[model samples]
Target: MAGRQPRRTRIGDAVVVLGVACGLALVGVSGCGRSGAATGGGGGGTTAGEVAAAVREAADALVDAGSSKARTSMEMATGGTRVTIRGEGVYDYRKRIGRLKVLLPQDPSGAPVSRPITELLAPGALFMKNRGAGVPANKWVRVDTGTLPDGNLVTGGVTDPFTAAELLRGARTATYVGRTEFAGVPVRHYRGTADLHEAAQAASEANRRTLGAAASEFATSEVPFDVYLDDQGRIRKVRHRFSFVNEERSAPVAVASTTLLHDFGAPVDVRLPEAEDIYAGRIAKE
Candidate 1:
């Protein structure tokens, strides 16, 4: 928390995971950002061309701020299903199960892959899906809001919106990747990456010179960026893939939060089991 900015106490869903131990966090955002906009669209005087760049810039800052926290928000549409993901947390050290809160459309009710999806939060790839009904409702594991699979991506949901906006800000110069319609919205896609080599050099200089300079360099550390803006002039989709440069090894991942709350006005409590319960063949982290 020494160098981190004061984060917003978000409700509903935000991609923000705070890694308390390593002092790193991640943030993600949904397609429809909580920009405090009304349901009616096209009121803003800004065009897609003018605002796209700035939006991505805002998203990049959000990601950098959230990486220390281990959180993110990704908007994915598959097979007529619109998934607004607010993800935070990773389980294993090598990146295993991640935590997620999926906001699904209710009118159609449950679909095949209707439950929340978890991905790898540690510096690796991990995603699991329960295709069949073998898994029953209420059987899903419950965990704290700011906690991850093994406690990796906590508070990721809250941070995602900002990250998406920042990435879009940088994407403006990544060559106009053109536009497409996704989920009934016109999307403008742009791609770009952070200069890892330069980032490493700057880090080295800061270390050899002034610690304050090193701290500043780390704050502006670059990472890859991607974005897709919707027709309503909002972020419809985003996938900001970032990798740390000149890292001796992958950084450690941890989860931290003041508390976790749910949409139905409920709370998620993550606690350790008793010794007797462990002996009774009950072991699960939620």
Candidate 2:
């Protein structure tokens, strides 16, 4: 292990895997917004085709913007374990970087998982800052993205609005529900069903990896989604509920995920931790 980038700590690896699923859940919906009461069946000019077009347009616009602030809330249950996560962060699609503060659930081994960890990400690198008793104060523990197979890292790449638009490719049906307001912003809401695997297969090579990792559960399931968009076709909100039978428990497990995107063109400043703060010191391999 000498001279190599340190292997991510055990906990860091778990975070990365979870983030893969979380990022897909967070950024998988885009495009489609307010068009003033048009329905999906060509009612008053809102056809299913038009709805799909709107989603694609919105998704394009988000990718072009490069970066934004995101807030996500999620709940998942399997067997007797239930996990809830709430996070807010700045996501940069261009660099595949995200600086997030997340609240995690208890570990599988029954250890109480840490809450609200701040993380930095890239295609090959993931760094975590957890102010726990065993960790150094203000130091970031680096987690190698290679630790997980198939290109999963810290989860912010495809979550970028621009790349996330690829998810709409799997949409089987679309309906314009009517006008609404989100956080006082005039918007439009739409509902649809999509095959998660289809979208993953259509994503860009770089994005497909992250998407593929997250779609493992929903691969065989056609899930419903509710999407809200602003007048300019920017994504405002997206909601989805996923239900499946737990393979091990032979019981039902359901997950609800919601993402809110805002602060378009926000400044995202990410800095790696200084050297002195790192707890691990690697000896050169000579």
Off by over 4 Å in 1: 1-159, 170-172, 193-220, 245-286
- Number of backbone collisions per candidate, in order? 60, 3
Model 2, range 28-139, lDDT digits (tens) per residue?
A: 3332333332223323326766786565445555655677898876666655566677678887756666677767655666765556767675555566676353566566
> Which 10-residue span in candidate 1 carries the lowest summed lDDT?
257-266
Residue 285 shift from truth in candidate 2, angstroms: 30
**Candidate 1: deviation at residue 182, Å?**
1.8
How much does candidate 1 score in TM-score?
A: 0.32
Indicate the TM-score of model 2: 0.65
For model 1, residues 136-227, the per-residue Cα lDDT tens digits are 32233222322222111123322222222322332323434666665566566545543322322322121112212221333333444555
Off by over 4 Å in 2: 1-45, 77-83, 105-115, 121-127, 131-165, 214-221, 244-248, 272-286
- Show the lowest summed lDDT stretch of 10 residues, model 2: 1-10
For each candidate, the alpha-carbon lDDT, in order, equals 0.30, 0.55
